[model samples]
Target: MATYDWLFSTLGLEQWCGASGGSAPTSLSDLAAQSRGETGEQAVDIWELPFPSMDALNDACPAFPQSRELTLGLEEGFLDIKDTLSVVLDPITQPLSWALDAALYGILNTPWWIVIPLLLAITWAVSRSWGLLAFVAACILGLAFIDHYDYAMQTLAIIFVCAFICVLFGVPIGIGMSRSDTMQNATIPILDMLQTLPPFVYLIPLIFLFSVTEPKLYGIAIILYAIVPVIRLTNLGIRMVDKNVIEAADAFGMTDRQKLFGVQIPLALPNIMAGVNQTIMMSLAMVVIASLVSAPGLGVLVLRGIRNLELGVGLVAGLGIVLLAVILDRVTKASLARINATHKA
Candidate 1:
């Protein structure tokens, strides 16, 4: 007999408990029965330990019996509302899809020669460090030589788009948070939830909300996962600006906007850039996981390797990701250094 069968029978829940045919099978007996192909009826496992009677518990708590019903109702409610949500969200989010597609297409279609030189030029302009420039050049060449350039570029395109959007939106939000205590209080918990939620969990609701083919599915996930650092850092940077500097700006007859742009933003540039660096790194980390939702990149190859159990493919793609991470990290840090130098001057 199942461990809880007697309790259920005593409580008049035998009908609900599936114990009528005989004494209900214990969990182990049920499994063994199934394995032996003797499954006329399956046994249900009920929580009975430390409880005197099922009826007592049920009478004491009607909610426990209704929990499954409540869950089903919630699921139905979400399904009913999902279409309404899509109607509202699609138009607003279309631009993200366009931006991501354009970036991916531009990178993939452009000649390697043109693309490589353009990247090198940008690296030189930002860092002005020949050593760093050479390292970036070498890394790109190596990725290309290994035929991982396309995958690398796809990953780069996604990171570039997502990270830019993060900075573009995150900075303003951070500035607002810095200016208003209420806004900060309102936003911090949301940011904390996003940062602490499991990375894979970000995709679950998104998968239901958008088709696998839509770039925005992964785009939204990437932004949500990576945006926290930039927002926090930007807020911290602006708030940390010296009061004396603000007073000087006011004394010089600077307007609020002027003080913010000329005095505060420049001073806050280091922290903002640091946030950008972290955002980029986080975006890179999500690339592989994002591939599950049709995000193309080295992540796709990594996924391929895992699914196929090909060690060489996974390891090589992983190495490509590491290389990309290093290149991005060095370039952003170098730019931050330049900003600090100018701020000091």
Candidate 2:
């Protein structure tokens, strides 16, 4: 009775025993042993765990903590390029690093009141059209008006660096893709992986490979997240070149390489530019999440707002990002148009 009470109460098995006022064997092992000796209708199963034999007992738990160092050994030695390239990039990338830091410093040092009017003037000058200029002005002032300028600039800095690098690398790769089928085939899958992976997931591997303070930390993540569209558009634009144009170049006795350089790439410039515009936009989008990893600028404000539940702070910083994205998109699209018009003329 004592065993029955403990077993029933402890395992909550009394519910299964129900009607007969809860009289049953106290243990699964006792039932199992009795089941073997019982014959015909007297048999029963007290356990849900299917066991063909005693093998099931030890097989239930998982084995782990298997240290590879003790069990087998390191799989081959480390490759030299991985470590060598890190050292080389650390020194050679100084100029780019300083430019970004300078941009951030420039914004941080300026007073909010001074920065607002300066921003409005710059927007008006670059945009030229009154409405475009006002829209740009309002966006900048709205961020500052709501007290978000500083954080916004940090986001701007990251995007500025990353997008510039994307164009720097993406345009050339796109041009190359336009010229070669093998390269496009090899490159597209990698781009697809980059595009498809969740943004948060990119930081995990990056954390191991580089410190949070490193410039390339955010630079590489932004590049990886943003490179796809530009490269694809570059490839598409080049491939979309009219066959007649190619034939005309050939008829002019232009070599294959010459034809590609002179004609196909120029024709595809719009698509390549469109890709760049998208890359810049994506780099801006990443700033907020990148803030968690010590990325500076507007996202830091956004992070602060969220961390403290400061609604005003988060909303304003977010608005600043919108302003920056619009300005960048407009500037890039305008440049693409000017380039295309020149090419056509």
Give the best candidate by lDDT: 1
The C-alpha RMSD in Å for every predicted model, in order, reads 5.6, 10.7
Can you give the TM-score per candidate against the true fold? Answer: 0.84, 0.70
**C-alpha RMSD (angstroms) for model 2:** 10.7
- Stretches > 4 Å off in candidate 2: 1-96, 106-128, 255-257, 337-345
Local distance difference test, candidate 2: 0.71
In the range 95-178, model 2's lDDT, one tens digit per residue, is 656766777787788777776677666655544557766776777766666656667766776787778878888888988887
In candidate 1, where is summed lDDT lowest over 10 consecutive residues? Answer: 55-64
For residues 1-345, write the lDDT of model 1, one tens digit per residue: 333445556777656644343434434655686679875345544653435444333433332253456677877887888889888888898899999999999999999999999999999999999999999999999999999999999999999999999999999999999899999999999999999999899997778778889999999999999999999999999999988988899999999899889988889999999999999999999889999999999999999999999999999999999999999999999999999887873
TM-score of 2: 0.70
